[model samples]
Target: MRVGVDIEDGGLARITLRRADAGNAIDLAMARGLLDAARACAHGSVRAVLLTGEGRSFCVGGDLREFGALSGAALERHLMAVTDALHDALRTFAGIDAPLVAAVQGAVAGAGIGLAAAADVTLAADDASFTAAYTGVGYSPDAGVSWSLPRLIGPKRALDLLLTNRRVPAGEAAAIGLVTRVTSPDRLAAEARRTAESLRRGPTAAFGATRRLVAAGLSADLGPHLDSEARALAGLAVSDVGREGVAAFLGKRDPDFTGGAHRL
Candidate 1:
């Protein structure tokens, strides 16, 4: 399998891209595997998620070798098949309430960029590099790159990367808001895990509400956005976890967010 999924008793789900020899490239099998992993992790029991890649590189992108073997109609079919699985996986990850964390290293190109951007927090290794490889290969963006990239880095910067296909180093990526943080290569995995663990203790319902509010901001007017913010805050304030949080603050104690009484 090109993807690996592991869920621990503590509700931490780790998803790894496993096609090391192929630079963790996404082929049909890999896409399906990703879809399956996403489905499995989209559950109330999953408090947080960690996404990473095995071997020297995180992911070099789609399986070009497989793509090269196809004709016109065959190529079209393959593209649809691969995208169907990939888009579903992305949607599943986005729909889940848990915080998403990614630890990326080496070559993060093409769809790999989208994968990293989907994370609520992305920690890129110092040596990691990013590029939008689609245009170079006579293709357009996929895997939410078009949607997420512009939102993360602004339209102009996103266009620069996509049009030029220039490799953005880890430090530059962080500066441009493409990644949440940058860590030394040796510390990437450990740091990402720590981040995930911290988020796991958070109020899931509140987190979900926050995510929705931000997403809503994208297309909403100022008035509508403010309305959403007010509604979401008011709703969460009465939730069990929210109540505990407030009580803990006044009591000078740590709040145990049980993700209380919130259903997905």
Candidate 2:
């Protein structure tokens, strides 16, 4: 399998890119594998997901070699198929209630940047670097990179990266809002796992609501957004997880969100 998926007992799903030899580049098979993995997480009892790459680079981008093998309409069709699966995977991950965490290292470019930015929490190794390599290869963005980049780093910065394909080091990437934080390379895996585990123990339904709220707030007017928030909070307040959370808070103890009847 080009993608390795493991769901732990506490509902933490770990998705690893297994093509270490190719810098985890997204070939057609890997793209399909990713979609399968994302669907598994979405359909299972997963409460959180951690995405990581197995080797020196998180991902360099798509497999140009594979693309280079084709031409004319064949290339177009092949790329469409690859992006279709990859985009579906991204959508599936976003639609899931489970929060997604990504730990990126080494080179991150093109679709790799898209995958990292799509995560709710992106942790980058200090040595990691990011670049928008699409233009360099005479290709446009895919895997939602164009949409995510502007939202993440603003229009000017996003355009600059996309047009120039200049490399942004980890520190600069973090400062520019490309990643949530930066950690030492050695600590990337541990920190990502710890973060995912922490999220796994929280109220997943509330997390999902909050995620949707934030996404909606990006385009929603204040009055309607407030109404949405009110409705969401009111509904969650009566839920089993919410009740447990309140009771635990009043009792001065940690809440066991996983033990709730809803288990959401």
Candidate 3:
């Protein structure tokens, strides 16, 4: 399989890009596999997701060699199909209650940047480098790179990267808001897993609500956003997780959201 999906204990779903030889590039099959993995994670039981790529690099980008094999309308159609699957997978991940954590290493360019940015928490290895390689190949952005980049690091910076295809090292990428944190390459996987596991033990619905609120707040008016926040908080406050959280706080204990009979 080009993508590996494993649901470990505590509802932490691990989605791995398995094309190490190709720098985990997104070919058509891998795109479809990612969609399948996303659909699996969308199941109600999943609490968190961790995305990683095997080998030295996280992902270089789309499989350009595959694209280069075709021309004319055929190439256009092929790319559309690839993006269709990839975009749908990203949308599915976004719509899920489970928060996503990405552990990126080595080269993170083009669609790889989009995938990293899409994560709720992106942990990049010290060796990781980011570039917007679309324009260099005479292609426009796909996999939501155009939408995510401007929102992530602002339009001017986004344009500079997209236009120049200049590589941004891990430190600069984090400083520019392209990644959440940077760690040593050796510790990247462990840190990501730890982060995902911590999230898995929290209130899934509340996380989902917050994710949606943040996404909406980007384009929403302040008044309407406040109203949305109010409604969301009210709804969650009455939920079982909320009750457990309150009880735990008062009892000086940690809350258990895993549907156990133990005290909060």
Candidate 4:
């Protein structure tokens, strides 16, 4: 049960799930730490986040040891509490003001894959393999994968992986849009950082607004979508970050964003 976070180059902050000896499996402690780290990142001055695991395996889903010995209502309560705890972490990532990039390698199964999808972008190692391991172990999907994955790759492709519990390799995962990029095992982190930094250096207000609008646009009607987009763009134009960005473009200079001028 280790929690470590650091500021990386180009405003990309990293929160590592640090149980290397246990493959960084999502236990109650790890889940709580993850949620806490994400919250801290949100309130701090960082522009982007990088989520990664410290071991060979990215994550192996819920820790069975946390659930294997429970019984009766105790088991039910334990499962429900832990599940919601994870969902809260997922929600933090889902609603973050800045973009998140996940670096995945080895096994990304069950809730681990859910965490990957919750990220704004993902970079995976070619040797990476993901699965809906829930069914294999007499469980089902948790951590909001059912909702998040479909938003990413669509229902048809998402259902195929969820229903079949099939292994989605890194290359095929990228082809199906599960992963944004695939690289050698050693390069996944660098690739994730590259993308995170790009987002960090862009118009921070525009990125935050776009993320908010697109999320609402998914279920909104056309009129509402336009209304939301218009408001978002209008808001961006007056924002401190936005104004600096526009000024920089016109002045042929780089924009220097100090972060935290507006509330998300």
RMSD of each: 1.1, 1.2, 2.4, 1.8
Instruction: List pairs with backbone clashes in candidate 4.
Output: none
Cα lDDT for residue 203, model 3? 88
lDDT of each: 0.92, 0.93, 0.92, 0.81
TM-score of each: 0.97, 0.97, 0.97, 0.93
Q: Distance (Å) between predicted and true CA of 112, model 4? A: 0.4
**Which runs of model 1 end up more than 4 angstroms from their true locations?**
259-261
lDDT of 3 at 170: 99
**Per-residue alpha-carbon lDDT of model 3 for 1-264, expressed as tens digits?**
999999987789999999999999999999999999999999888999999999999999999999999999999999999999999999999999899999999999889998999999999999999988999999988888999999999999999999999999999999999999999998998999899999999888888889999999999999999999999888888888788889999999999877731211
- The whole-model C-alpha lDDT of candidate 4 against the native structure comes to 0.81
lDDT for 196 (candidate 1): 96
lDDT (Cα) of model 3: 0.92
The best candidate by lDDT is 2
Model 1 per-residue lDDT tens digits across residues 104-201? 99999999999999999999999999999999999999999999999999999999999999999999999999999999999999999999999888
How many Å off is the CA of 222 in candidate 4?
Answer: 1.1
Q: What is candidate 3's CA lDDT for residue 128?
A: 98
